[model samples]
Structures are given as C-alpha cells and as structure tokens.
Target: MTDVQTDTTLCDPQDMAGRLHTALSDLVRDCKARMLRPRPGHQPTADLSGFRLGITWLAQQRQMDSMLDLAEQLVREAPALVGGHGRKPETLDQLRACMVPVLRALPEVNRPPAQRLEWLFGTLLVDELQCLPHAEVMAVLERNAFQPRHWQYIVPYLEQNLPKVKGTGLSWQGQERRRRLLGYAWQACQKAGWADRAEALFRRELSVCACYGELAELLVHRGDVEEAQTVLLKGIAKYNASRPELTMGWLDRLESLNGVG
Candidate 1:
C-alpha cells in the first residue's frame, strides 16, 4: 500500500466491524454456556456484561453456521429466564464463523484485492496453510493486500512453508516494513568490514536468514577472497546444521557468483 492507502486502512470501519463480530460472537457463546445452570427457572440476576454481549451478538454476529443450532436453543428457551425479560436469542451469524474451513480459500489472486484481504483476516485463525493446497497458498501470497495484518500472518507463513522468509526484519513500523528490513540487512553487511559480522548479528537479533552470498561479498570487498570463502562456507555449514535450506541457498549463490553454475 502507498502512504495514502496505508493511512486509510488504519481507520477502516468495516474491518473493525468484522473483528467486532468475532469478539461479540465469542462473548455471546460464552454467556450462553455460563448460564447453563440446572433448573431452568433458577435465573441469576441480569448482568450488564451479559446484556451488552447479547445485544452486540444479536446485532453484529455473522457466519459460523455451527452455532445456529445453539442460538435456536437459546431463543426457544429465552422465555424461561425472568431476568432476561422474555426475549428470544437471534440466529447465530454464519458469516461470523471464523472456522477452519474458510481459511482454505485463496480468493485474493482471482478476486478483488479487498475481498481477498477480508477472507485472509478471517482465515488468520485457521491452522497453517498445511491444510490448504500448496497451489492455493502460493496464489494468495502472490497477490497484495492493503491489510498489514495480512503481513502478520505472512511472515510466520513464509517461515513455516519456505524457510526463505527469515529476514533481519523490518524496523519500519508503518507500512513498507519489508523494504526497511532489506535495507537494514544490507547496511549491516556493509558496516561489518566484510566480516559478515553484520549479517551474523542480524540473523542472531532478528532470526531472519542472512542473505544468500552476502558473506563472501563482504570478504571480497576487503581483499580476502580465500578467508571470506572459508568464513562463508563455515558459517553456512553451521547455519545448515540448523537451517539447511538457508545454507543451501547461500552455497548455491556462492557457486553461481563464481561461474561454477
């Protein structure tokens, strides 16, 4: 998102509404379960929390058809509770169910960006894209969303799926964060006197994988190709012991740079 877009998304009400829907649904479900005391006639005094939550859920709850039956039961039995004032609970919102199934849909690439992002926010609660098809997850990531929250889901996602997602991290707080992270990674390498001390420091601090082929570049610039190569190899070996793909990517970059590929 550009500056204007980012600023605009920060205050979007529909986004807030969806989030509110989830919160109120959870509250209503909890209250319903809480008042399940024995003897239907025995009603506790009306609690403000319960009333507010019930009102909100009735007004805004969406999705999650699974709770519809429960909602029906609550409504049917509402008259039994004297303190509740002879009211029936409304239908549970099916659109509000942030269940595991909806997260599997990757509509971003094929649909409007806003809609895709909306779907992603709901899916954020789903288990890893492991349950999603690889092709579908790839498609979702390829498209962009105005939602920074999507990035919250994206980082761990890339880390979990590709292992290439590790980075020194974006220090930039407001939007364009990924770019700032890249900049810091490069700057650290440049200031380390070709020791790759910066990249190493970055990986240690940020848990981001050091950039591929960066170590030797640092050493080569310092006029010590051999020592640099050794540092690069050994560093990569150690990294490989823990993060083999990272090590492999660096090794491949090294070979490619040397025209061995």
Candidate 2:
C-alpha cells in the first residue's frame, strides 16, 4: 500500500467525470456491448446485511501452515464468494465449516509481503468499475484507504516490485491504450476528490451486503461522531442487533482514522 500523504480529497468532480467517461469508453471496447446504464445509490439495506454476514462468515473460515491447501480448495468450490455474496450458509455449524480454511489462510493471503491477493482478486482489479463486487471491495478499500496505521502486521512491499501484469507495456498500441484508460480513471479520481467517493459510500444500493455500524463508528472515531452515529443507527435499525463485531470494527476504524494508535 502506498503511504497516504494526507487526507486530501481525491478525484475532483470535473476530473472524475472525464475519467468516468474514459473508463466507460474502455469498458465499451472491452465488453463490446452497449454500456450499462449506471444508477447511483448504495446497495439495498437487505443486501448490505447479507454481504456483511457473508464476509463475516468468510473471515471465520481458517486455513494455515499444514492446513493451507484448504484455502485453494475453498476458492475452487465457492468461487462466487471470491467476489461477493450468495446463498447464506444453512446453519451456524456449516458457516463455520465453510470459513475455517479461509480464516487460517488469511494471515498468509492478506495484502503485503505474503500478498495472495492475486488468488482472491484473480484477473480483475477489485477496484475496477466494471466488477460487480466493486461495492464490497470499495468498503474494504475505504477501510484501508489512506489509513495505513492498522496494517502493522503485514510487511510492506516496494511499489516498484509489485506486478503490473495488466498490460505488457511493450507495444505502442498497448502502451497507449493503458495510458488513456488507467490515466483517465486515476486522474478523474484525483480530480473528483475523495468527497465524491464518500458520497458513493452512503448510497444504499451500492452499500448492499454491507455493514454500517462499523462505518458509522469510524466517523465517530474521527470526531465525525454524527456520521458515525448515523451509520450505526441505520445498521442496527436494519439488522436489529448491536453486535460486538460491528462495535469493534467501528472502534478499530476510528483508531485507524485517528492514526497508528
């Protein structure tokens, strides 16, 4: 992860619009179809709950050391989860059973020196606009975005050594295409500013299969207590529980937002 300089706004509106336009154009070329119309708003309340549970369950599944092969097996059988939600587990026991391998392996796969993001993310950038799982990925990204203090466990990797496997930058056309496409998205994001992304976070349609208590809690920790409170209230109202996990996540988010402490 790059060191976040400051909480500077990213992707100014004018910049983001242009980037969005360019991304949409590349998307057309890649998909070779009429572009899908985009309607903004977060995920539905119900889906957010489902996604929240799904990820929680996913986190619980553990695999480690000698138990490691199970990580590969889990992805092979339940590939849908690599991206987003699906049918809930039949029972608490089943849920735990499903997640154990992943839980054990996460120490190994989580982003960093042992970064196995490649396996989970596959060929797609979790941050990419075209990916269906983007909303969930965005939550993960936001949780870590410009907030590096929490990642003390994962050893850092040099950005230079990290793979840029997206396009072999050899050919002129390939280089140009990559430039026009990614440059536009990044420039747009930087220009549009972080506020646009923050607004995107609050939308229910995009926040589906998500958790708000934690998100709200982060705002509170940041002294944006009102936003934090709102996120938590909405989450509890929707889910009908004041879970410790959510509580802890909120606190952690706040702590991280505040800095390494």
Candidate 3:
C-alpha cells in the first residue's frame, strides 16, 4: 500500500523485485491448491484477492526485468483460471495491472529491444493492454517513450480514439471522461519528450470546450497559470450557452488562478 517513488536510486530494485516475486509465487501456489480441492462435480472458484495484493506489491517495485519471467508466467496461467477478453476476470485485470509497470520500467535492462517490445506488446496480451488503467498506460508510455517503436505504437493508438470526441452530442460524463483521457495521454506524451506532438494533438483534436479544460489543467500543473487561465476563458466563452455547467467550472478555475471569485 506504500507509494514507491519512481526514482530507482531511492530504493533497492533487486531486493524489492525479489520480494514481490516470492510473494506472487506464494499466491499462485495457494490459488492452485484451492483449485485442486473442488467440491464433487463442481469446479473450484479462483480467489482473486491475492492478485490485487500482488499488484499492490508490484507497483512499489521500480521498473525492472528481474521480474519479467514471473510476469510472463502469470499471464500465461491467468486465462485458464480467469478468462479475459470481453469477460475480463478481476484476476486477469489485476495481473495485467501489475505486469505493466514492470514492463514500462524495463528500459534499464539491456535486453533485446525488439524481443522485449514484442513480449511487452504480445498478441495474447494486446487486448488486455487496451483494458489497462489510465495511470498504467501513462506510466508505460512514459517509461518506454525513448523507444521509437513504443512511442510509435502509443501515439497512434491514442490518436485513433480522438475522433470519437469530436462531436458535441456526447453527454457531459462521456465528454468529461474523454477529456481526461486525452489530457492524460497528452501529459504522457509530453513526459516522453513529445511536447510538440502533444500540442499538435491538442490543436488538431482537443482544442475546445471540455478538452480545453484539460489543457488548462495541464498548463496549471506546468506552472503556466496565465496560459491555463487563457485556455479556460476561451472554453468559458465557447461553452457558456450550450454547456453552462461545464463553462462555470472552467470559469471557476480561471478565477482561482487570478486569486479572484
């Protein structure tokens, strides 16, 4: 449950990785024992609670390949117990969540770049990759951004989903979610040294209304409060009539930036 800072120098990667690996191994062993002792004519249910606990442990470990083999094994064995795809079992989801951060931090190891990339984006795992949480996706992109193929894959995947946010017919919740996704993706791209690409994406796809709200927040975090205010003001003017509540929120942000309202 402790938050491990992403900095490798602050912690011992080997010790942390080994501890998590052993913990996950024990969990799988226990789950296997439970699966074998099912009631007569009834398949035993797989307990997923330990998987989440493993994921929490995995998240604290700095990104490293020391645990990749363990992750691959878990992924291979997960489907038999927790069927994925449309029926994304919680165990499989938790497994993917744990494995992604490790994969993202794999750049420190001197593995075969192409082979590791293939393993990270494996065919059997691509579907599950789409189901990764927003934070995990951003972490993966940020960690692998230096790799041309990784950057190439993430940018297009996000761009392809941009069109769905173009129209104004979306419900407020739908629009808000889209805005957050795009905004976080932009932040990820920027963190990967793709600020130009992020800006281009904002201009080409998200330069309006709620998306501007996202942009403003990004700027605010970047300490460009004035620019954030400008973006929100523009959004306020544009969305005031049809999206009054959203605009009001934007205006509130704008005024807060100026120490007013």
Candidate 4:
C-alpha cells in the first residue's frame, strides 16, 4: 500500500518567486563585484559561493523564469568575461573557472517547457563542463545522479555538441570531456537500475579513452573476458594512432587478462 501525505499549508508562489529573485539578484551583484576586482589565480571562490547560494534557493523555488534569466545572462556574458578576441588567455581562463559552477547550476529538467534549448548555450554548457577540474566534474556528476531526468536534456545536448573524433589528430581535452560525460551518463543510468540503458550509452560511441576502458573493465570484472577483449581491441585499433598513450594503456591492461590478449 502506498502511504499518502498531504500538505497542510501552502506557501504563496509569488512570495517564493520574490525570494528567488532577491537571491539571484545578490548573486548577480557578487558576480559583477568579483569581476571588477578579479581575484588571484583561476580559483573562483567568492563567485562560486554566491552562485551556489542563489542556485540552491532557485532549485527550492523551482522558478523557471528566474533560473533561465540567470542562465541566459551568464551564457551571454561568458565570452566577454572570458576576454574573447585578443585578450589575455589567463584572464579568460580565470573567468571561465569562476563561471563553471554557476552555469552548472542551471536547471535541466526543471527548465520551462517554453524555453528553447539553444545550441550555443548547450555548447557553452558542454565547454564549461569539460573545462571544469576533474574533482568538480565528479561533484557535479554526484548531484546529477539524484536528478535522473536531467539526462534527458543533458544527453541530447551532448550528442548535438560533442564533436566526433576523427583522423590522427585528437583534442585531448575534448576526449577527456566525452569520457567524463559518458561516465556520468552511464552512472546515472546504472543508479536508476537501467542496466540496458547504461550499456547502450557506454557503447554509443568510442569518442574517448575511458569510454572503452570503463565498459571493458566492467565486462572483465563480470567474467566476460572475451567480450572485454573485443571491446578493448576495438578501442585500441580505433584510437591507437590518434591517442597511442591511452590506447596503449588499455592494450596493456587487456593483455594482462587471460586469453585474447
């Protein structure tokens, strides 16, 4: 039997919206202040803190307009804030470091139905996700696990924006991002008890080193050495010339397994 709980008192939506706006207003103010007097290094201590506070409140409120407004503003200003055009790369890097968290806080499943997911904004989000330090990516992924529907938006965004790998020239950063994205997406599926979904996602593309590594490792751990060997071989053959180091590592690991080294 399902137990049901009912709300005894309802909070006014308008009041919640007001509070959301106020919180976001403070975040925006802090962003500008921090931007004016930039901090040392690419560490975004203050700006990230402010964005976290506002985003936490925004999530609680579930106010789509407020969330979109903040997201749009941040996305629009990012290139400039990052000092696009002949500006110092260091400054842009620092700015990006500061903005990554704020951008990650943008609501995915809670986004308004009316809001069109722009490719440019999606591209920005992917870039931010890729550029974020590994530790931060894991943290974001941990949060994403609780929001299963977020993958509905995030996966499509990635499919559209994540460039396919080609030729012997590989963008290491892009590959790393793809690997992390796949890891998170697969983890999200697995956590939801969607084993088939996880397999499909992990096998969808060999765009990154870990895509093959993780899948192969899982298979090997599950006593499917032949399948694991095949997965690893395919990965090595496909990526050897372009990413010899990573593929070679996978090869070494595959060789250590019994049969079909």
lDDT leader: 3
Query: In candidate 2, residue 10 scores what lDDT?
Result: 49
Residue 223 deviation, candidate 3, in Å? 6.5
lDDT of 2 by residue, 169-228 (tens): 444344333323332233223333433333333242213333364345334534676565
Output the lDDT of residue 24, model 3.
54
**Per-residue lDDT of model 1, residues 1-261, tens digit only:** 011122222444344344444544554555456546334654344322332233233233332232222323333333233213223222122222222123333331355544454344223223221222334434454544434453433333332333233221332221123323333334323432333444444344333434434545655666766755666676686677776855686677566556321
Clashes of each: 11, 38, 0, 0
Predicted candidate 3 versus true structure: per-residue lDDT over 1-261, tens digit per residue = 122223344556566565555655665665566556534453444454443444434445534355565566665555444532223365556666655655555554456654544445442232322334556545554554356655555565566655544333256655554555566557547645676677667656454325877777767766777877888887788779987977887877777789621
C-alpha TM-scores of all predictions: 0.27, 0.26, 0.45, 0.51
lDDT of 4 at 222: 55
Show the lowest summed lDDT stretch of 10 residues, model 2. Answer: 153-162
| Candidate 2, lDDT over the whole model | 0.34
What candidate 2 gets wrong by more than 4 Å, as runs, is 1-102, 105-114, 117-212, 229-261
The local lDDT score (0 to 100) that residue 243 gets in candidate 3 is 78
Per-residue error for 166 in candidate 3, Å, reads: 11
lDDT (C-alpha) at residue 80 in model 4: 42
| lDDT (tens digit, per residue) of candidate 4 on 93-196 | 54445445444554354544212233223434435323344465455455533444544555544454444422111566656656665665565455455556
Q: Rank the candidates by TM-score, best first.
A: 4, 3, 1, 2
